[model samples]
Target: MIEACQVNRSTFFQCLNGKRLPKESFFEHLLRTLQLSPGEESKLRKLYHIAQIGESVYQNRQCAKKCLETLAALSGNLIPQIYRLDGVAQLTANWASLEGDNRVFQELCHLVQAEMFLPEPKIDLFVPQEDSRFIEYLKVLYRNSGEKNVRLRQLVQFPQGRGKKTRESMEFFDSILFFLASDCMGYEAHYYYSEVDFADTVGVLYPYSVITSTGVLLMNEAMDRALFSAAPAILETCRTQFEDVLCKTKQFHTPFKGYQQTVDFTLENWEGTTMGYQYFATPCFSAYLTRELVDKYCPAGMEERFDHYFQSIMAGVFYVSFCSEAGLMDFARNGLMNEFPERLVPPLELEDRKTVLETMLYRPPENSRLYLMDPEKTTVSDEFVFSLAKGKRIMTYRKRLPKLRMFCFQEQNLMDAFEDFFESLPESSYVLPRSEVERVLRQAIRCCEEQMTFDLSNQIG
Candidate 1:
């Protein structure tokens, strides 16, 4: 093949042996000399390019590991309190007279604020990639969005390739905080995957944009030039383009209105064999709840439905649940569950709760595993519980009130982050090892049993 390709034998051998990368000409010549079919040639060319760029599965794995670590660290701090910009001074801008891109961007930020002040305000954004300049824009949108009746819809690239993920393209995790920060504040994202380079496909025409009913700001890729338009024709054209692009996309983030919708979504995507992970303040009660327990404790009309949901959640599945020590003690003492309303379901009896802990220790389901999370070692929140099922979805349930809510994240790239996050937790310093967890469970069981005896003695006295 080297002879047919008119390449030096030693150089060709070096390339084959991984000592040196194949040159573009040499790679193409070798493909021609081999008389390979179109598919074979394409695959080889891709492999050659990947080798030249030093992209490997190992690098992607390492990148993914780092991203997961960052995510775990940022988990507790993801939600930012909504800021009111009431007294903030608005920047005055003559759009046509704007000289620099930075000035235009500032003006655009002001425009976004103006839109937010309107009743029923909605902002449409097209972000081709994780451009640094737009971070400020996103910040503005999320900060005040908490209190205002504002809506944010974003169109973002999936940040991947046609085949395996590339290290350079794995920026989804970097922008995940933005997606999660505004989750409760009327935020939605639609995503699309391009067979070609994602940035190259959309970046040329619409690198970054913020569109509202009244105005539009289009920023160049360099972040140094922008076009601001309030003309009806220009605004309509941008709106049409956004809708056209949105039509080719799929919804990336989903918000569950209530328990029924959350349960329905879970059952519809159920995977029996997948090992799952949960991060909650206490053990996942759904996995441990028996039919009788559900019938006894579940709300009046929700018995059969809750029972079915609980059974479906646990059936033929393995799970590793991370619980806080304080939460376990509370469960052992008060029988309180984060998921169910105490008024409706009521706390379990001391003996019943003891039995549940004992079952977890001795006769636990074959698929169940528990780990204790050290509060001092991790930043995970008690208000949020994350349920991750492989190849299914990651459900985040917020137990705090005004109202309870669930957010479902099912995008593949985001799922990969959660999967890595979960897998890394078993080895994380925040989560206790199996032996430590077993010791704690025994302690909790003994505490429950002693509490039961004390109450019985008091009644006798």
Candidate 2:
């Protein structure tokens, strides 16, 4: 390979190790560098494009295998247009509505530094920032995102909601044979009391947002700080609230199976002092409203008490995540829905708002808190998420129409322009097994984006 490249073996090996990206002009050398088969050059070029697009979307070992399969699909041709974006869906609509106060949005704007990268960069739309602190901002923001596609400032005003469309063409000749792409966009069951929360589908409609009930408090700092360790105490103070609901209903179902019959134990400190842990089911708002009573007004030794149990309770949330690399989604099959293969996000056109509503697909029982149709009996479907009725065309509720169309048009144009312009919309996607984790990430990202923006704006002021 080295001799074919006209470089010594050492230099050739260096490029292979990622120590160096071979100069663009040298791409042709690859034909001989690896002693490729006939017509391999074009295929290798297309693969590079795929890798570049995917680098932003996936970051695990499984992603690597998916990439290889994509390369194999091309069969040795550098056909850029050899791919197709025809079926690709724009998932970034309303995602671009950069709410003025979103921190993640500000962080991305600050981190990208268009002024530094582009000639005669317009500083007008840019936030005045402390360049020194901006890098740190990216690190912390990325950490909280758990390697998922939580766009910056997107929470305050999502591009789709804000009338922006996904403007990219993530075309590849053929999608790989793997389903890893669908890992994002679903809820995790472990977080809720169990999948039974909506009969198992509570998350499908209200999602963790159900917890954002009026009385739930929002304490921003406690979460932003590496305060993960501090939450257990808060949970200890709030455990009874969860238990009380179960006790009241006379069916305290735990996500952990077979424990329904386990004798309930009143939470007590090491000294055996019984304390009430009831706060609110929706802890984000609960934390906000109860901040003074919790973060500030810990009952005497309560802060010193229940610390251990608090940790255990938080763990029960069972947090895991997957992110979108570009602003679009690709699903040869539905990974989130265990019963069917479908694209969770629907594709939108230039001026079309394709409101995406993920139905747990199965109706829950009347007494079901969440939409859980015994997994033993229920199944996922092949129904496309955006096109719930692409073929079947069932009537969605009247209320779903306004926001539904609203969600569609906002993303349609943006989706059109982005895919056309950027060649792809890399989705930083996420799938949460625990509603709490899903809830917290959504709220915190919103808050963090808002906080950073407000803080930066203040500094500029």
Candidate 3:
């Protein structure tokens, strides 16, 4: 700031952080020195707030870790407060797992109390909850944990005992969270205690609820809501549950079907590959714990795969540049993706984006840009998008008539791109083409606009 404004360092730095205003003479000198425009000033203001928030996360690291430590120690029944304090605690747990901070973990555990006592805070649930049955199961499971088998069973049976299966400890987190997050047609609370076998893999129970022609938009609208509401929870639960399974499973009755066991990958044309190991053994369990052991005790091969993730994300962008030209990404499919569907625009500050744009209209023969420019080569493959993360075909369609194949190519590119983008970041916010890194935000804005339109239309009608 000082160098740009030709002002003294102290005042310039202080001003940026909103610490103190410089003297009029200082301000005049600084303003003239910088030659800023009104629009630039506004952008700078926004950036300043973002930077502040980033700093706060750094500061709160210890708090999140504490939350998690608390969670691991808790053995009592589930408190209703768990539901109430859901958001912030969930955020902290996820942050701790990814960032490895005691503060966030501690904050995660503290959530049990927060939800019980604190009024719902000033935030929305990204992943909406439809049925409370799963929450009920959670409550039961929490209470049952340390009890003798008989007492544990007795505790769980208290929640009306209508659910079909005895709440397996695994199912407590899996079936419960999945049911809460997903809305399968044939699957219901009734199905849980009954004989109906609705097919789903991992935790998801896919319904035969087919979207009709007239209901296409309706399905999309409902989908947007469900995904928005449950995404955070889904991601968080999956991380915890799978990591727990990975970390603790010396012996188990049920096999660890890879995370994408039930999803079809035929969309990208890479359909036949059966993913027995990677998705289940690692992807679902220890994303942050990469293969190459960093320091002393991390996973092996994490660092290598991270590089591949970057390549795939760029491949996603390359596909977007060719298919949409405008850099827009479309919704891929259900049960398979963690990110909202949309293409990422490169940021001005990003050297990668600069390199991409430089080669867009013209580039050397061997350049990747030349390959991306090809409509044929650039097209997303049915095998890529439709195929499961490890190449399995989805056996069931949850919502839409499994309009699964129409855009599998883009979705595959999207899936890998997201993997690359997310895996590379230190925190969720770094989960940007990041807001910090993204130069072009039109794609995100478009999603927001579309969501608002659906909301308004629903409200008006």
Clashes of each: 0, 97, 67
Best by lDDT: 1
lDDT of 2 by residue, 229-262 (tens): 1133443433345334334331111111111111
lDDT of 1 by residue, 1-461 (tens): 77876789899899889898877788778887889999988788767755754555435545644543444544343544433433322233323434465565566667777787787787898754646555555565665555666677887765356334343334554455445534345777787765555345654744678898778888765555667777778888988998898898888767877656654555444455367777777777667766677677877776666666666667766777878777788889888776543244588988788778888877778778888876665544466666777887777655544445667777766666556656766765667777876787788888988998998999999
CA-lDDT, candidates in order: 0.66, 0.25, 0.28
* lDDT of candidate 3 at residue 435, scale 0 to 100: 32
TM-score of each: 0.73, 0.19, 0.18
Q: Per-residue lDDT of 416-457 in model 3, one digit per residue for the tens?
A: 332332232233321222232233233433444555567689
Better of 1 and 2 by TM-score: 1
* Candidate 3 stretches greater than 4 Å from native: 1-78, 81-138, 142-175, 178-303, 317-461
Q: Between the candidate structures 2 and 3, which one is better when assessed by lDDT?
A: 3
Task: Determine which window of 10 residues in candidate 3 has minimal summed lDDT.
Answer: 277-286
- Considering every candidate listed, which one attains the maximal TM-score? 1
